[model samples]
Target chain A: MTGSLVVVGLGPGNPDQMTPEAAAAVGSAEDFFGYFPYLDRLSLRPNQRRHASDNREELARAREALAMAAEGGKVCVVSGGDPGVFAMAAAVCEAIEDGPEQWRGIDISVVPGITAMLAVAARVGAPLGHDFCAISLSTNLKPWEIIEKRLIAAAEAGFVMAFYNPISKARPHQLSEALDLLRRHLPPDVPVVFGRAAGRPDEVIRTVALKDASADMADMATCIIVGSCETRTIERDGKSPLVYSPRSYRGGSI
Target chain B: MTGSLVVVGLGPGNPDQMTPEAAAAVGSAEDFFGYFPYLDRLSLRPNQRRHASDNREELARAREALAMAAEGGKVCVVSGGDPGVFAMAAAVCEAIEDGPEQWRGIDISVVPGITAMLAVAARVGAPLGHDFCAISLSTNLKPWEIIEKRLIAAAEAGFVMAFYNPISKARPHQLSEALDLLRRHLPPDVPVVFGRAAGRPDEVIRTVALKDASADMADMATCIIVGSCETRTIERDGKSPLVYSPRSYRGGSI
Candidate 1:
């Protein structure tokens, strides 16, 4: 039998948010590979096995999964949120490209899921209803200067910005620096939404203005969305305000 | 009977790709409002009613849905992809913000789904593996100059770009103009993916180098992804090449 390797996203953290195709991929695989937390979400059958690893060991996990699939084992790699967005799908493709020739020919399919940014955006009104860009705050792969440049460009271009991996125990200052940079370009009233563990039981979605947003509002689980000048907020009586960027933009200062 | 308005996404025409939460929302709502084509995707029960409207009538659709929900009817507004991303969620929110006082009090929830860009990114390799921005080429709601400015900024910042509503019968020249702008800043070998109706039965995923990409390759249904400078393609013997942008980027000249 020619075993195939399928990389699937488990959505953000909710079972209800997981796509049926992704859930089916998780069910069909005999072996699973991912970081421990993501793999922990899956309730596997007795015949299946899981190979869990450290958080940042994406390449090693991908290589091991590819090797097993090459040996005709049905392998599945799980990722939180969409696998293609700063996740394991790239690592798996990287492994296939650099590995043995047989690995290239192995069947590989990437199943997309509801990414965190989308989940977070849903909780808010529609901050991403306008044009937007997603940037990871972690400097593990790219330089901080590149992040700074992208932030400036996104702000100046009037694109609403979503920041992933915003702050962790290791890097706590990047979110603050990012906000500081945005405050210089965007209007003070621009909404900033900090969505922590969005869609889960402990989901906390908070919206603050650009002038008041700070690093402490976000954690590693949090995805921060900073709106453009055209973004607006609707205040409801005894309800959390709805924030969204309007679809129409007449140059700047809307 | 207090009513609620839930805006749900029907993931790029694939039922299996729809999340259980969105499916649940669709099931619970009695009245559905959306563009006719998007509403046509739903296999509603006998009791469920669909209020189909024209394509450009977003505000009218939102107001009608909100009005129905305010009258103690469970209403659902459907969009093709994620509702918050350039879809009906913003329209709904805009209606509420600008509409009557009671519309604000109606319980509203936005359910997320697998967007076309995510589905397209999954079909190919992870071209959106790093920092990325989504731009809509249709100049219906926004100015052409804003789109032009974003395209240039996204290119300068080295963001993998996803273009939604790439081309239509009306706006045929925007995609070509967008590509011409990218060619000025990006490397010629950068991969451009044209994923038309991704995840649907007639899904077509095609890739070309930036130099060879044209507006003719795309249609209104296509979502075009232009890779950053770091995007790479791995050629297989007979199958289509896998295109991905490495998570790691060493500033410039990767």
Candidate 2:
């Protein structure tokens, strides 16, 4: 007999944010697999096996999760934000396909959660209703050159942006360089919101101009949202927003 | 008697996607106010006052809702997504501040649901992690020029995006124009995902290059999630983008 696997999204960083579907999967799981940091938030049963680790042993950690699921454990692989969105769902999927049994008859369900984009978008105003793209400044996978090419193209096209892995200890200047590329084509006062530790304690969401935001940020659990040329920020409620665009309405009495 | 207002998010477009907290709020409310489209989803009490309307009468209908709560009704103002994130929470807050004795003692609580951003991100890989922004393409409140600026700035700064109102009847050409702007800044091959009726029936989530996505998409219910330059479209087990950026180290015994 084979057990099922469910990849649940535990929200950004709050227990209350877990969906009923996600919470149920977590409560009923025989084993939980996730990153060391993200896994600590769950209140797993005593018998549940939690395979968590630091950033050093990613491959080994991913493999162990499959072994548990293969052994007929109803494993709940959790990820901060949504599992499929730049999180652990793919790793789990990869392991299942590569395993000896091909994970046949194993129910794999991907339950959704609040990702960083929405959390940050809510912190700011509604800036995500157009043609936009998300980019990672982390150069671990591809060359920085390729990243640069993509950034340049996105900038020229005027796509709004959600940035991930933007700045870390090692890659300190990537964010700045990317900003410089934007400055070339876009105006200096475009809306850039830095959402630090969104939905977590010490959460800080502040909107600033493109130039100002570039200088004021550090790399500790942050998501950045940059707007287009048309983005505007008015002090409607005494808040600092350099918003990109407003709603174009005629008949609607908003 | 003083009445309270609870703004609960219904999480994406699926009932299963609703959070426990959100469900509890809706389940316990004596009166409900929302767009007519979502009334069928929530099971209100027989006597529950469910005020629904289309877009043309949003504010007037909402004002009437305020008057209802002003007269002391335990109201649950519901929206498709998070209430505070571009939904009716702000209007409720404004009504609370603007009205006289009837609104003075009313309490307002905001409960978040899975917004379109989260749903789109989940459909794609994790591009919304680091720095991101969501912008509405519909120019109902602001002008198109402002949106273009925000798009330029956000894209230039390497932000990932989730586009709400990416396409609608009135804004058909605008979406393509927005896509063109994004394509100019980003690579032609940058993956942009269109989430049509996410979590609802006829839900279509397809990740294509920015160049290819601009054509053939126009729906009011559509949400577009565009990947960062680093975001890839992998065909894993014949699946679309089962993963995204910020690859954590999976280092545990397998």
Candidate 3:
């Protein structure tokens, strides 16, 4: 059999959000590689084997999948959200660039899925309907100064923002510091959304003002969306309120 | 009979990219409302009615769907990519806020789909693996000044940028002007991916240097992704080259 490697996204946590292409890729693979939680999301066939690793072992996971595929095994690498968004796709590519020369010939393709930010945006109306930026707050690979600079620039540019890995036990003060920086630039009434486990059964989506946002409101599975100056919320009698940023922007100072 | 409305994304164009949740929402709806091209992507059942309209008539289309749902019909409003990303979800919410009071009571939900940027990013090997921003280059709704300011800020902030609605017949010069603005700040060899009809059968993804890119390479169906300073490309022996941005930044001057 010809060796092949396909990176697929399982989507947030909902089976219904998984695309047919991703599901088909998983079904046809002889070996699956991913983080423990994402690997658990897939149901292995009788003949398939799974390789589950920790979250910090992305490079190791990519090497394992590449090695298996080079030995003529059909391998699938999975990520919770779209693999291309700060996930396995980049890790796989990085491995191929640095691995053995023969490993370059292996067939590789990335199947897209619904990412967390967009899922959260859908759930909370369209806070990202206008121009927006996505920044990961984890300082594991990059410095906190870089994240701070991007946050400040994004705010000054009037782009609505989505922050991934906003808060975790390892770093408790970053999210609050980021929000404090935004509060200095953005309006006090700007809408902020905390989406935890979006698209899952126990999904929680709350829209708060920038003045009321706290770092403790988010965890690893959460995506925090901060709206632009134009973002607004519509009040409903008995239904959940809707929040969105209008596509048009009137003249304003940045 | 109770009424309901769902705004769903159809992914880029490939049926395999459509999520099961969005497919089910379309399957169960009595009325389908969308742009002519998007509505054409869906197959109607025997009792389902398709309401296809022009692209510029988003508000009118939202009103029509709301009116139908208010009269006890299950309505599905569809957009090509994720409905919440520069699509119909915001329009529907706007209509609900501005329209008759009775429309607010209609059950509405937004089902997320794979957006064009993520689909294109997957095809091009994760240029968005790091911090990124997405901006619509269309000056139809917003002013060219704001777009220019955003381009400058994003470039200054070292963000991988995705440009949606890059070029159209009416605004032929906006993309070139935008590229020219970026040329002033970014390096000349930065990789730029022009992905047209991203996941569709006729999908075309081409990577060119910042200096070699032109306006005619894109249409409304295209999403232009510009790499950050850290983005790199790997040459293959006999296959197409792969492009990606590394997750690490090694102390670069912004």
DockQ per candidate, 2 decimals: 0.89, 0.23, 0.84
Which candidate wins on lDDT?
A: 1
TM-score of each: 0.98, 0.70, 0.98
lDDT of 1 by residue, A74-153 (tens): 99999999999999999999898889989888899999999999999999789999999999999888888888989989
Error of 2 at A228 (Å): 13
Q: How many backbone collisions does model 1 have?
A: 0
Error of 2 at A246 (Å): 8.8
Query: For residues A48-138, what per-residue lDDT tens digits would candidate 2 score against the true structure?
Result: 8878876535445656766666678787878787775565665665554456654534655677887676667655445543345666677
Any runs in candidate 3 off by more than 4 Å, and if so which? none
- Tell me the tens digit of each residue's lDDT in model 1 across B87-148: 99999988998899988899999999999999999999899999999998889988888889
Best by DockQ: 1
The model with the greater lDDT, 2 or 3, is: 3
